[model samples]
Target chain A: MIEEGAGQVDGTIRAVLRDVLGLTQDRVNAFDESTPLFGLLPELDSMAVAGVLTELEDRLGITIEDDEVDGEMLETFGKLAHFLRKKALL
Target chain B: MLRFGPQDGPVVIAAPALFEEANRTRAFLVRILRLLGVHGIAGALPDLPGQGESLLPTHQATLAGWRDAFATAARHVSAVATVSIRGGALVDGPAPVSALWRLSPITGAEQVKELWRIRQAAHDRPKLRYDPARFIAELDVEVAGNRLAPGLLAAMNIAEPSSDAPVRTVRLDTNPRPADLKLPGRPLWRASEPDVDEPLAQALADDIAAWVHACVA
Candidate 1:
């Protein structure tokens, strides 16, 4: 089971965003639980979400379902990290 | 004549994705592999049934058919492994190739989403009227640029291929690498300018070549 506060997940999420979504380093690093994703980030539009998810799954060896994602899951960096940790447990 | 390296050296079947991606990366990838002493085949698949000069329409194309085309390309060049970029990774390599190299593989669903975005971009122009939500529900409509048959879309909406071949992935900027090889630059391929960063390309080529050598050795 993955720990909740583990920093690596956050870093991974940030990296995926930068690499796949083309978010600037400053934009990615500034993200927190309140940063809001999905509808918030211009780069995180519906199309970019697929690439980001695919990158996470391939690199992290996690499986994500289309139905599993919603605004809450991607609400912020912390939320996204939390979601990944939960997925890792399952 | 396009092939590089000795007649029997290891060859990587270069399978690039559609449209702009193919235009940007195909030949460059092949050239890099050739420089690294492995023969790379860039023209690995025939045009989709309805795409290019083919008499069929895009709707006639299937993922399985494209796989067959990729297999034929593999057989044609006796490829030992496949080098797939972006959506190209969706094509399953035949059993002859023992390893698969995927670079930032994209999902079919994502491809559809991108197509939707492209359609949205043409809002200023008079284009066909179609809603992606309705199209996806029907599961046989064409969107973006390619024909998305149900089976093809199903096969494409995956991060990994169904092949038993061992897979190695190279994430451009995310994966940790030696400081010298780290991709510090943005993925310019996504921008409207769509320029290739030679340093990044060279770094990726080097990494791939090393992996191929290790696999074949």
Candidate 2:
């Protein structure tokens, strides 16, 4: 069983954004839950998008369905964090 | 645990190149081993460090790193025969495919370089960014190939047949299976798109199957 903590999940997302996709923490953390990742980050191309999602799935130990993802959910850092927290349970 | 059969002879593993090819050939490669039957066991291919199913957080893997992974997997498998699709360069040795592309190069490597080049230059008159072109040009000057990192060059160079460890090849197609496989003139290779008359696609699936069987047989 995985441990609890929305904060921990936030840390995981931040790490993947920084290391795998090579984004600065300042760049990622600046936006709230409504920021659009695909629109904002030039690096967030299809490969990087898939890669970041894959990294999250691995760390969280849960598979994310394609249908579950909508453009609106990942609009901001906070929303992405919230979505991940929910996904971790799923 | 999907245990491969006959703890003797050699092990055959399918190693394809990146992106679309890997996704396209994965299932067909697996089927090839199944067809091989008692010849060899095409060992399971897990995702690379940063790609496919084995994604891990805080990990960014390079091609050389992937070579090490392949080496590790090869060592772990217990068999007299081992097979890999486009993995010959890593297993055998690095050789450039620049010459092959001299006439008509449509391999993924070329496409990647092209896309990256466009992105680097911001699509300005199809010229890559000054830094990358200069960087790649310098690297190209060092190697026999042109405009590529040494590591990438090595990865692209698979035309060189494997002689380092006695790996075998069994190129297959309709009406003409590999001479060694000794299958009937009309082999049972599945054709996903016969209507398109794409021999390469049909042969790829069939050849992979034959390669797997050869390893077991």
Candidate 3:
């Protein structure tokens, strides 16, 4: 089971990206804190973002409001993990 | 092909979501169910208003209009049970539908996102353009090669199985992970190419038929 921590969250996020977007395991694992998402990753486009968010919601059991989404929250892999962890807390 | 089984027998309405899934699984599923001794009617639900040789244009379509069409489809064959697949599960349940069988059901948000993704892939866009939430807010986005009106998006957003309904889910796991250890069966949906997965369809047919039989019994 994935434990509650930054490490776990990052790994889970990576897994989701790999599974949902059909990204290679190596490619997803290569994503780190500095790696930009959204505008940066070609696979992490608008529609891909929706799929990612839906998977996140299902796996984490958290409700993400429409207004809450912006460039900042999804800027990087680390940022996405931190955002999800924060939601998990709430 | 809607009516099946003995004369005046129970009819199962096959309500599959529009677009690629409908293109892929509708006919295959219907045929499998018939062989399994289940009366199945595959609904040819139009994704857009003016679609499927209809006279009305898509721009004029509303959420209620789509619901009316589904209700009409269900009425044509007098559906006693509902077998909703993929995004079709998001449609409002037809009246008198006692049992709801969903196969790999997806949310309205997923549908919207998928439409955009398919569009993006089609165009080979360099980056993501449409934000799903904001796109929906615009209330007039193109989806699955058709127009997505405001009302229709609202309906899709709210389309979910009710508490009172007896809903069962058959998740086809294509990429199994440790988290999906509980659900049996390999992911046959994506195992092969060309959209039609006969083995997966057969498994779903058997599962749905058994469930329908038990429900009626």
The prediction achieving the highest DockQ against the true structure is: 1
Question: TM-score of the B chain in model 1?
Answer: 0.73
- Candidate 2's displacement at residue B156, Å, is 5.4
lDDT string for model 1 (B74-192, tens) is 78777777877767777756537877877766666666555544544433233334344554566654554565566555555443454578777766555443222335444433433
The candidate that wins on TM-score is 3
Instruction: Record all residue pairs in model 1 with backbone atoms less than 3 Å apart, i.e. clashing.
Output: B50-B56
Q: TM-scores for all candidates? A: 0.58, 0.39, 0.61
Off by over 4 Å in 3: A1-8, A25-30, A66-68, B1-11, B18-56, B90-92, B95-98, B104-165, B169-203
For model 3, residues A2-74, the per-residue Cα lDDT tens digits are: 3556566677678778755667789998887889988988767665665577667756667676457778998
Indicate the fraction of true inter-chain contacts that candidate 2 also forms.
0.00
Return the candidate ranking by TM-score, descending.
Answer: 3, 1, 2
lDDT of 3 by residue, B1-217 (tens): 3445455556677665555546445456555556555434223233323444457776666656655776677676666667776776765465466777777677776676666655554555555454766656765566546665666665656566443467877673432223211233322222112244456666666777777777877
DockQ-based class of model 1:
incorrect
Which portions of model 2 miss their true places by more than 4 Å? A1-90, B1-9, B38-42, B56-59, B91-162, B167-217
Q: Give every candidate's TM-score on chain A.
A: 0.84, 0.80, 0.87
Assign candidate 3 its CAPRI class: incorrect
DockQ, all models: 0.08, 0.01, 0.08
What's the residue-level lDDT of A34 in candidate 3?
86
lDDT of 2 by residue, A1-90 (tens): 345677678777876676455556797666556666866767765445544664566456666654466566666687788889887754
